[model samples]
Target: MANSTAKKNILNKIKQALDTPVPLPFELNNEAVNVFQPAKEELEIIFAEAFTKLQGKFIFCADENELHAQLQLLISSKEWMKIFCNEDQWNVLYSNTLNLESCDAAITGCEYLVARTGTIVMSAAQQSGRTVSVYAPIHICIAFTNQLVYDIKDALQFFKEKYIAIPSLITFASGPSRTADIEKTLVTGVHGPKEVYLFLVDKTA
Candidate 1:
């Protein structure tokens, strides 16, 4: 009888402990506010580090001359006889010398560069569209430093603020398409571009 009473007491104590109210780890609104606010320099550093770790190339150019030089060097190194680019972007960034069909690579402009996850946000309306960025062997994106945002949420908010009408689709490309299907061995470029490069121009300069 005594042992039965002790067991009941123990059970009640545990129940009471569990029922006690504990403080939340953090206030939800404050935490979200903190996450949404990020310094520009901090975003730049984190994005570069994360993107590099993903095997994506990050190129920073101070001015238009340097940007052109980098692009020329990359084109020569890849031996890209012809390049595919959106007509609008080509008009703004290049002379119309390369045809669309014969191009070995496709370069486009991105809507936003996400810092936290090292992602580039692309809209269907952009020059690259959906097919060129994914179908081409190499995908090169040009973005101004002003386009960098702290996180995906911030990127979305930026788009909302900037555009009254959103595009039909938005793609967040983090790195080259990769799969580890057989024996857990990873292979890249199976579904999409084999290489991804981001040319970030410092607009402040």
Candidate 2:
């Protein structure tokens, strides 16, 4: 009975919310705000551009196998040779060459990257180490285009109802971690990766 009543209350709240209309300013009666829906290609272009503006970069892959191959390339890339990893780990393939001080970036796969707010969601797991994404000057994430969502609420809802396991650490990363820690000067890459790159795998079948 208690559970039934709780469910009923939730339904009622939802109904009321649906019935409620957003308040409008009194300046002009019946004035409406236009919401432009971005097309698929347009959204991609915008997403990529927005990512670039926020110091984000990306590398495209064809499929899961390609993603793995590309990841291997990234893991051993001369560009980021200063970083380390544990080859024994499932997703971590290069643990032997990490330079703690020189390390300034991370790489991880995401369940999805929310498009509405331009935030990426990464869950903590054995292979998806927290350090790989947080302990660096830059972060690189890969996800398919289909995994993109509109908002955080949708992301959490999908996780709760489908994925079922709540992550020990769920991070909503929008951009590089920055803070005005010392005096008044602004600084970047102090607490976390200062650059983030999202590669959307659209060619996957």
Candidate 3:
């Protein structure tokens, strides 16, 4: 009888507490806050600096002709016999006849470039898909100036506005893959590409 009474008292107290809900301890502010100082430099310059610092190669092309010339030069210099490019548009753009199985490097297009973090945003929606970026030893991204955004929040907003439903997979790559898992020693490219290259083409210029 005493146990039953105690249980009833606890249930009644819970019900009373639920009925008279307590207010939040502090008032809530819904306004967005800027935590970091405003970036003074141009987005391209900032992105280049940050990307290079993270061991990513950055290239700027004024036009398609310049981009082709630069790509040809790089390919010749590196002597990468088979460059993997599956996208039909990219293949036609660069005049590449790619074979995936024997390619030395992979070239792909990105969704957006985050200038603040020097990150490349990619999605499975693109023809390149997920594997094309990480499967190869060297991953090269071809992006345009207009695709650049200042902050990650801006990128997320862009994604939300661009698509009715988000892609199945969205990835942000900052540079070549690196980890310090074994013996706390820093290692690069254990899980992904050893080298990452970003070719930023200036569509405005």
Candidate 4:
């Protein structure tokens, strides 16, 4: 019996790792996110405020199809070298998001966006190196409105039910990487990115 249980557990983990993402059964509503809106009126206010706080600004474009120009600023930054992406977006910003030499300051996209606490889950893969998201001085993540869920509970449920694909690794990041590890002294840019910026762009449905 013990062996059978152990085998079951192993199989469950394997299934989770190899399963394709399954679409969630629950619909996102104000009931789940409370602030969810068709116009995202309040959300726009939050976006403005939070976006202003991002340091050394960078952009992770959710729509690389040359649809949004808000990313022009980031694309033109003097420090903006190049973005690393799985696919090439030729003319949107004249960018070549490939061959990331360092994770010092790079941005990536997220699959599942949690609205409750403003968290995004990143599953490490070839395009998105495991270290690229956490090892950089600043990490920026872009997510679509439809991708956002209420919280981690809903996010995990969706993952378990849907994407059972074997993800090499999984990470749940809320804000930047921080810790009061040294004498309770608050420090930034310690273990990972001193700052984490999330951009939520909703679709016009």
- Could you give me the TM-score of model 4 versus the true structure? 0.59
Tens-digit lDDT track of model 2 for 1-205: 9999999999999999889966766556442432534335544555566556666666666666776787667656746655444324333553434564566445566766776557778777436556677876667676777777665666887788755678787888876777887997877778888777676778435
Model 1, 1-205: lDDT tens digits are 9999999999999999889967789765654455444655777788998898888999999977798899989988888766777648454565333555456778888899989889989998776667878887888888888898888888888888978898889999998988999689999999889899999888864
In candidate 1, the residue pairs with backbone N, CA or C atoms under 3 Å apart (3 or more residues apart, or in different chains) clash, namely none
* Cα error, candidate 1, residue 75 (Å): 0.6
| lDDT of candidate 4 over 21-137, digit per residue (tens) | 677798655545533344244443443344444332323344544224655454465365665444232223333554455533466777676554456677764356586777656
Off by over 4 Å in 4: 1-68, 75-78, 87-104
Clash number for every model? 0, 12, 0, 14
Per-residue error for 85 in candidate 2, Å, reads 4.6
Error of 3 at 200 (Å): 0.5
Q: Which candidate number maximizes TM-score?
A: 3
Better of 2 and 4 by lDDT: 2
Estimated TM-score per prediction? Answer: 0.77, 0.61, 0.87, 0.59
List per-prediction Cα lDDT, in the order shown: 0.82, 0.66, 0.89, 0.59
Model 2 score (lDDT):
0.66
For model 3, the superposed segments whose C-alpha errors exceed 4 Å read 1-17, 20-22, 29-31, 93-101
True lDDT of residue 5, candidate 4: 100
Q: Write the per-residue lDDT of candidate 3 for residues 4-71, one digit (tens) a residue.
A: 99999999999999999999998886558656666799999999998998899999999878988998
* Overall local distance difference test of candidate 3: 0.89
Better of 1 and 4 by TM-score: 1
